[model samples]
Target: MDVLRYVAFATDASGGNPAGVVLDASGADEAAMLAVAAEVGYSETAFAVPRPDGGLDVRYFSPLAEVSFCGHATIATAVAHAREHGPGARDFHTRAGLVRVGTSVGADGVITAELVSVPPRSVPPAPDDLPELLAALRWSADELDPALPPRIAYAGAWHPVIAASTRQRLAALDYDMAALGDLMRRRDWTTVDLVWRESETVFHARNPFPPGGVVEDPATGAAAGAFGGYLRELGLVALPAELTIHQGDDMGRPSVLTVGIPADPAEGISVRGAAVPIPD
Candidate 1:
């Protein structure tokens, strides 16, 4: 029942996104997890109970509700596990499905973790839902990139992909938090992937996670993975592409996520980032 807070995707303490983690949460129930997450007050908190099979039963919670999965929290948990039990592979039975996380520590004592998510999938955004999304974001139909039309993509969770016309458009993220939170709750979305294309393999993004009781997320690995699927599904980018997604600059945490998409649709996409501990 120990709580550890770690920030993923950045080496600096003040840089990456912070997530709360509980390594041995066998005694905590759903209500307990929710209360702990709310008290932690980060974007997300991870709870893991060691299983008899040597894996883990993992759950994620935001300040508002429980989530199916969370990448940053997973990364933090892996590093924390490695710190206590040494670096290795860890399996998580998440609400979304099975998640495999691996960790390694450098000679300099820096820890890095990578998570392989469940089978990813993507579909075009519902015609009816697009208008609601645009309204919530205060974006016009004409402002969309057109090349990257709206879609809902999933790795471990669902995120609506919305591409902005320019980097400037993506950076300015003033919106109605309460209204957007209501919309996300209605759709059961984890986050809105607001993006700008810097190149075929490079992008800049901002994730609005109002329903999580946060105005925005500094680093969003779930959205980044789903976005890789979105680009591949829409034929906006070629196969086996290594894409770079830069996020959190506007919020000052400045995180970077690297994703790889395979040629086959059935394969689970790979998302990689560096994680360092948030000092006690």
Candidate 2:
């Protein structure tokens, strides 16, 4: 299994989250995928096995365990696929659901990809669970933004959305990793979506993903998809609004995620970004 190491979100390799992409993993099984992910030591690794039906069966494995969906790996794998086969549309059957990706190269020679996420849904977190989550993150109720209430949102995976009133509160992240990981695993949450509103359609986010054995994700499309749902549910943005997500600035990776939310409630939101290879 040849692992293609690539960093997603940032044009330069050194500035984004690095992911392990196995372009061909026909011979590898679940055990092999787990082992390779651990060996690669990245937050997540993607294994793509081509199917006879012309689609691919994609699986995501973090250094610790398998996950339902991974945004960075999907972006990295799609870009890697486009680099070898020429930019175009592609499909993959992931653990979460069927995902479709469209790819193209710009005049500046940067490979860009936009993925239509599965239908998103949002629900309030269990009131009983919120206190535990708050404890793990050392967050008080007053620190939360009143406009964006806490909710558990899902597109491909579930995330508890927590909005801080200020960027300073979001930037000073010091959470109990083990405690939060335990809470997340028991509740089947993907990450803690800590965010700050910069404007009506622009926001800054930071995801604490201890369950994935990573401190944070530089660019998270799945979370962005769910975030759009959160905004729509709360009527935070106008109908048919386009949103921008700025993440990883605190980590120095500096990722930008674009979200296109349609007026229809059932339609999938679009997440667009560009990725490049990380030279080893």
Candidate 3:
């Protein structure tokens, strides 16, 4: 199998999150896909199979297990496909739902992809889980931002959205891997979205993806979509807003994701970013 490596949400190869992309995995079974993903050993590997229809069937796998959806991997795959097949719109039929991606090349020959996620939803966190969640994160309730509150947000996948009261609090990330992993498995969470709002339109984020056997994800487009929905649902942001998310800087791999929220709350959120091929 030919596996392509690309970094999403970064202008340079040094930044953003790296993902494995398989342009054609039509003949590969579940086991084969899993094996290939493990061999690639990125946070997530995206497998695309061309369907009889024009759409593509996509699946995402981590080293340890398969996930319903992965944002960075999806971005990488779309950009890769565009580079090979000419930039345009594509529809991906994923386990989560039908995701539409639009790709374009800039004058500088940089490829950018925008994905519209499934309709997002948010549910309040169970009261009993708060202590366990906080304990696993080694964060006290006092450190949480009261305005943002706590909830499980879902766009293509579920993520516990936790906001820090200060940038300092968000930066100091130290958690028990086993404890957090177990908790996430029990809760069926893909990642924990830890965030600190810098302004009304700018935010910094870190994603703990222990369930995928990853300590942190540099840029998570799915979580960004869900976060845009969370803000709209809670009336935290004005309609038709554009929000900028800065991630992976703490890990020394800076990534930037732009989210567009429409006026209609039921509409899917759009997450846009640039992807670059990683040189072997």
lDDT (CA) per prediction: 0.87, 0.89, 0.95
Better of 1 and 3 by lDDT: 3
Model 3 per-residue lDDT at 22: 95
Ranking by TM-score: 3, 2, 1
Error of 3 at 21 (Å): 0.2
Winner on TM-score between 1 and 2 is 2
Residue-wise C-alpha lDDT for candidate 3, range 1-280, written one tens digit per residue: 7899999999999999999999999889999999998899889999999888777899999999999999899999999999889999999999999999999999999999999999999999998888999999999999999999899999999999999999999999999899999999999999999999999999999999998889999999989999999999999998899999999999999999999999898899999999999998
The segments of candidate 3 whose C-alpha lies over 4 angstroms from its true place after superposition are none
List residue ranges in candidate 1 displaced over 4 A: none
Candidate 1 C-alpha error for residue 32, in Å: 0.4
Give a tens-digit lDDT track for model 1, residues 1-280: 6789899888887987899999999888999999999999999999999999988999999998999989888888888888899998888899999888888888878888878878888887778888888888888898889888788889999999999998888887887788788888998999999999998899999999999989999999888888887777777888879998899999999898888888887777777777877888
The TM-score obtained by model 1 is 0.97
The lDDT of model 1 is: 0.87
Give stretches of model 2 more than 4 Å off: none
Q: Clashes per prediction?
A: 0, 0, 0
The residue pairs found clashing in candidate 3 are none
lDDT of 2 by residue, 1-280 (tens): 8899988877888676789999889988899999999999988999999888767789999999999988878888999999988888888789889888888899999898888778889998897899999999999999999989999999889999999999999999999999999999999998888899999899999999999899888878789888998788778899998998999999988888888899899888788888998876
